[model samples]
Target: MQKGKVLSLEDRIPKIKEHRRRKANRRLIFLLTLFFLLIACVVYIQSPLSQINQIVVYGNDLVTTKDILSVSSLKKGENIWKINKEQAKKNLMAIPEVKKAEVRMEFPNNIVINIKEYSPIAQIVSEKEFLPVLENGTILNKSTLLADAPLLINFKTGTYLEELVAQLKEFPSEILNAVSEIHYDPKETDKYHIYLFMNDGFEISATIPTLAAKMIHYPSIASQLDSKVKGVINLEVGSFFKAYDEEEEKSEGEEER
Candidate 1:
C-alpha cells in the first residue's frame, strides 16, 4: 500500500479555516434570504395588493348580487386573508332564497361568492298581490312582479300546499309552464282536489296525489283535442276530455238547423 500523504498543522489549519469560511458564508446567505422573504411577506400583507379589490358573485338569481354582498359583509377594501369564509357563508345561508353558499379568495385580491338560490315554482295570489312560492314550499311575504309562473289561488301553508308544491316540483318544465292558474277546489270526499286553468284555453281537474303521475301525459292528451274547442281535462280518475256544455248545446243546435 502507498504511504498516506501527511500535511503539517500549519497547512491543515488554513484548509480548516477555508472550510469554516465557506460554511459561514453559506449560513449568512441563507439568513439574508430568509430575512428578505419575511420582510416581503410583511410588506405584501400590509399592502393594497392583499386587499379585496373586486367581489364577484356567481349562480345567483332571485337574490340580487348587491343583496348577497350586503349579507356577506365582505367589502372591497377588506383584507382577503382576514375574511371569515365560514361566517360569510353562514350569513348567506340565512337568506330565504339562498339554498347553498360558497366563499373563496382568488389570487392577488379577488373575493368570489357562489350561491345557489331556491327557485320559485309558483306564485300565490293573496289579496291581489302575487307572492312567490319556493320549491321548498315556503311562500315569500314579498310580492313579486313576475307573472309567468302558475298562479295558485286560495292556498294556505299546510300539508296540502306542501304536497301540491312537491308534486309540481317533479312536473316537466313544459307541462308546468302550460299551467296558468291553480285553484284549491277541495271537496268533502277529496281535500286534495285542484282545478287548473291552462294557457292553451283548457282546464284540468286533478288531485294532489295523482297530479304528477297523470299530468305528465297532458301534452299528448291535449294534442288529440281540437285546438278551437274549449273543455276540461279530468286527470283525477283517468285521462279524458269533456267539452263545455255550451259548446255541446251550440253544436246540437247547429246540427238541427
Candidate 2:
C-alpha cells in the first residue's frame, strides 16, 4: 500500500490540541453544574420553605387539636424534616382519651396528625354535674353530656364503679342506648347491687358481677312484657317483674272503686 498519507506533525499537533480543548470544556461544564446544585441544596435547607407552615389534625373529637399540638410539642415554623414522627405519636398516645395516634410529614411544609379516641360509655352524675366516663374506666372532667349516654348516679371512683364500668363496656350498643340511668343502690347483703332505668319505661335490678351476662338478653325480656305497664325487671338471682307500688295501688283502687 502506498505509504499511508502520513499526517504531518503540524496537522497532528492541531488535532490533538482541539481534542484536549473539547475534553477540558466538558469537564468544566460538569464542575460548574455540580457547584450550582450544591449551592441550591444549601439555600433550600436554610430557607423558610423547608420549615413547617401548617399542621392539620384528623379523627379527633373528645381531645382537642390544641391539646394534641401541645402534647406533641410540634410548632409551626419548626423544621419539618427534623421532627421525630415516632416520638410525637407517643406523646399523643399519652392522653387518656387518645386511643391511637399517627404522625406524618405532608411534604414541603405541612405536618399531619391523625388520632383516635376512646368512646364514652356513660356519663357520671356528680352533684348535678355530668362527667363523661370512657370505656376504659377513665372519668373525664365535667363536660357536655351526650344524649344517648346513660347517666350513672351514686358512683364513687372505687372498685364497685370500676366493676360496673367493665360490665357496661361489653354491653351491645342497642342495649346500652336503651339504658337511661344506672343507680348504684348497694345493700349490706349485696354490695354490688345496681338499678337500671330503661328508656322504655322499665327498670332493671342486677348485681354488678352478673350484669353483662344477664342484661345481654334485655331486648328479649322487654319484648315479652306488656309495654303499657311500667315495672321493675329484676335479674337478681332469677328474672321476674314487679310493678311499682304506686302503680299496683292505683290498679287495686281502680278495681275496688
Candidate 3:
C-alpha cells in the first residue's frame, strides 16, 4: 500500500470522548473546590471560634487592662478576624505609659493583648505630689510616691529634665533606687549642675551632659566609700569626694552628741 486510508468515525469518536471526559473532570474539580470554599466561608462566619469570647492582657502594670480595652475598642462577641491588630497596637501606644503593645488572636474565641509599659525613670516634685517622668521625656500627671524612685527638685521640663530622664533610664535599678532626690543646683559656669541626695546618706554632684556616663560608676564609687561617712561624690568633669564643711560637720556632731 502506498498510503494509509482516512480514519473512520468510530476511531475518532473515542478520542473526542476522551477529550470531553478530561474537560468534564476539570470542571467537576473546580466546582467541588468552589463548593467547599463556600461551605467553609459560611461555617467560619457562624462558628463560635470566629467570635472573641475571652480577652487576656499581660505585662500591664501602670496601664490597666480596662484602659487598653477602651482604647482598642475590643469587645466580646466581635469577630476575631475583624480585629485590627496594628490599629489596636497604635491605640495602645497612644497612652504615654504603654511602650509596646502586641495584639494576638488565639483560636477558639480568645484574644490576647501583651503590653510593655515604660517604667518611670524619675519623679518631679510638684508641690507635695510627684509627677512621673518617662524615659522618652514624657511627664505623666498621675501622682504616685515610690520610695525607690528619685525625687527631682527645681528641675523644669526642658532639655535638662530630658537629659536627667535619659541618664536615670540608663541607671541600674539598685543605683537608681539608692538616690532619694535630685536637686538642680546650677553653678555660675554650669547651668546643668545637679545634686543627688542618696538614701544611704551620700550625695552626688553631677552635670547634665556627663551624668549618665559618669554616674554609671556610682555603685562602684559608693562601694569604695565609708558607709558610715556621709560626703559628696562629685562626678562633674572628674570624680572626686568632698566631705561636708568642717563647721557644718562640727555642728552635726554636736547635735548628734
Candidate 4:
C-alpha cells in the first residue's frame, strides 16, 4: 500500500489541537499544585500551630531559667520568626554573671537558649562579707567562706589582689591545676606568700612572679621533697629552696641572720 503519506492536513489539524489542549491542561494543573503548596507553607509558618510552644534553657546554674527568660524577651507561645535572636542574646549577656549567651530556634515549636556562666576563682573580702570574684575581675554574689578555692586578702591598698589575680590568668594550665590556695599581704608589696596545700601535707611558698614558673615544675619538685618533712618549700629567690620548721616565725630569723 502507498503509506498514504501520513495523514491529510484536515485530519492532522484536530490531532494537533488535541495535543495542545492536553499540554495546557497539564501546565494548569502544575501551576495550581505549586500555588497550593506555597499557600500551605505560608499558613503553617504564620499560624500559632508553628509558634514556639516550649522554651528550653541549658548550661545555667547560678542564674535561674525564669531570670533568663524574663531578660531574654522571648516568651512562650510567640512566633519563632517574630523573636529577635540577636537582641535576646545581647540582653542575656547583659546580666553580670552571664559570660556568654547563645539563642537558637528549633522548627515545629521550640526555642533553646544556651548560657555560660562565669566561675569564681577567688573570694574578695569587702566590709563584713566575702564576695566571689570572677576571672574577668568582676565580683559576683557574696559567699560566707569557701574551702575549695583560695581567699584573696588585703585588696584595699595599692598592693590590691588585682595583680595576683591578673597573674593567675597567665599561669600554665598544669600549674593552675595543682594550685590550692594563694594569699597576699599588702604591707609587703613586692612579695606574695602563696600556700599550696597539695594532696600531700607539704605546703609551697611561691612569690608573685616566681609562683607561675615554679608551679610548672611542681610535680618534679614535689617528688624530691622528703616525706618526713612538713614545712614550707620556699621558691622565692630563683630556684633555691628553704625548708622552714612549722613553728618558725615568718620573718623573724631573716633579719636576725
Candidate 5:
C-alpha cells in the first residue's frame, strides 16, 4: 500500500491560524454589536426622546383638557413608560363630571386621554341661575344651562330631585331631548304631579313614578296628534290629550256651572 503523505508543519500551521483568525473575527463582530446595542439603549433611556412631548385630549365637553391633564398626574417632561394608564384613568373618573376615562400612550412621546363627561339631564332653579344636575344627582353650580336640557322649576334639593334624575336617565334620548322645561306642580291627590313643556309646543302632565316608561311611547303618541293643535298631554292617568282651545274649556266650564 502507498504510504499517506504527511502535511508539512509549515502548511498545517497556516491553515490552523486562518481558522482561529476567522473565529476571532466573528467573536469580535458579535461583541461589538452587543456593546453598541447596550450603549444605544442607555442613551435612549437618558434622552428626552423617551419623555412625553404632548398630551392629546378627546371626548371632553364639561371637563376641559387642562383639568383632565391636571388630574392625570402626567407631565410633559415625565417618562411615558413610567405612566400607569389605569391609575390615570381612575383619577380622571374621580371628577364629578367625568363619566368615563381612558388613557393611552401613543408611542415615542405622546399621551392620548379620551374622556366622556356626564351630560346634564336637568337643572334645578336657584335664586337667579339654574344649577346643573347630573344623572348621579350631583349638582354643579358652576355649570351653565345646556340648551337641550330641561329646566326643573319649583324643584328643591331632595329625594324627589334625585328620583327625577334617575327617571330621566331611563328615557330614550330623543324623548328627553324633546323636553324643554319641567315644573313640579303637585295636587292634593298626587304629590308627584309635574308639568313638562315640550319643545314642540305641547305641554305634558305626568308623575315622577311612570315618567320614563310612559314617556318612551311619547313620540309614537305625538305622531297621532294634530300638529296644528296646541294641547296638554295627560299621562297622570291613561294617556290622553285635552286640547288647550279656549272655547272647549269654556264650554266645559259652563256645563259644570
Candidate 6:
C-alpha cells in the first residue's frame, strides 16, 4: 500500500466548524417552530373567533325574541368559555309563559336556545272579564274575544274555578270544536240544565259533569234534527230528545174537543 498523506490542522478545523454550523441552524429552526406553535395556542384561547358567535332561538310565539334575550344573561359576542348553560336555562324557565328551556353549545362558534311556551285551551268568563286558561288549569294572560274559541260556563256551587277549567281542558278536541258558548244558571235545580250554543246556531241542554260525553255524541244527535224544528235538544237524560214549542202547545189546546 502507498503511504497516506497526514491531514493538516487547517483542513480538519474547517470541516469540523462547518458540521457544527449546520447543527446550530437546525436547532434554531426547531426553536422558532416551537415558539410559533405556543403563540398560536394562546391566540386560539383568547380570540372571540373561538367563542360563541351566534344565539338561535325557537318555539316561541307570544314572547318576542328580544324579550327572551333581554331576560337571559347571555349576550352576543360574549366568551363561550364563561357561559353557564344551566344558569341561563334556569333564568329562562323563570318566565311564566316558558314551559321548558334548552341550551346547547356548538363547536367553534354558536349557542342555541330552544324554548316551549304554554298554550291556552279555553277562556273562563268571570265578572264580565275573560281569563285565558291553559290545559294545566293555570290561569294565563287575560284576553278579549280575540278568536272564536268557545267559552266555558261555571255552574258548580262552592267549586273552584280552577277545577272547572281543568275539566274543560280534558274535553276531546272534536267536542270542543263544536261548542261556541256555555251559560251557567246555578238556580236550575238540575245542574244538567247548562245550555250550550253550537257553532251552527243549535242549542243543547246538558249538565256540567256529563257534558263532555254528551258532546262526543252531539254530531249524531244533530243529524236527526228536523229542519223545521229549531228549538232545543235536551240531553240531560241519557239519549232522550224533546222538541217543544209554545205555539204548538197553544194550537194543541185549541184542538182539544
TM-scores of all candidate predictions against the true structure:
0.85, 0.83, 0.79, 0.77, 0.81, 0.67
lDDT of 2 at 29: 100
Cα lDDT, model 5, residue 58: 95
Task: Residues 74-149, candidate 4: write the lDDT tens digits.
Answer: 9888878888999999999998889999999887789999999887666767777777776677776646565554
RMSD of every candidate to native, in Å, equals 3.9, 5.1, 4.3, 4.1, 4.0, 7.9
Residue-level lDDT of model 6, residues 1-257, one tens digit each, is 99999999987999999999999999999999999999997898789776778899989875789988877788888888889999999999988778899998988778889999877666777777776666566665555553655786663234544545555666777777777887765544764356778786677877667666667788888888875676578777776555558557867999994
The lDDT for every candidate, in the order shown, is 0.92, 0.92, 0.87, 0.74, 0.90, 0.75
Check candidate 2 and list the clashing pairs.
none
Which candidate leads in TM-score?
1
What overall lDDT, based on C-alpha atoms, would model 4 receive against the true structure? 0.74
After the best TM-score superposition of candidate 4, give how far the Cα of residue 187 lies from its true spot, in angstroms. Answer: 4.9
Candidate 4: segments with Cα more than 4 A from true spot: 1-8, 125-130, 144-147, 156-160, 170-177, 187-199, 246-257
Candidate 5 lDDT over residue span 124-223, tens digit each = 8888787889888989867486787899999988978888899999998888999999999999998889999999999999999999989998998899
Q: Where does candidate 4 have its weakest 10-residue lDDT segment?
A: 181-190
- Candidates sorted on TM-score, descending: 1, 2, 5, 3, 4, 6
Taking the tens digit of each residue's C-alpha lDDT, what string does model 1 give over 1-257? 89998999998999999999999999999999999999999999999999999999999978889999999999999988999999999999999999999999888899989899898999999899999999988888889956668999999889999999999999999889899999999999999999999999999999999999999999889899999988988899988888897668888999999
Rate residue 87 of model 3 by lDDT.
91
**What is the C-alpha lDDT profile of model 3 across 1-257, one tens digit per residue?**
58978999999999999999999999999999999999998998898878899999999987777888999888999998888888988888899898888999886779899998898788899888888887788888888876667889998889888888887887778788788999999999999999999888988888988887887898889889888777888899889887777548788999998
* Candidate 5 structure, TM-score to reference: 0.81
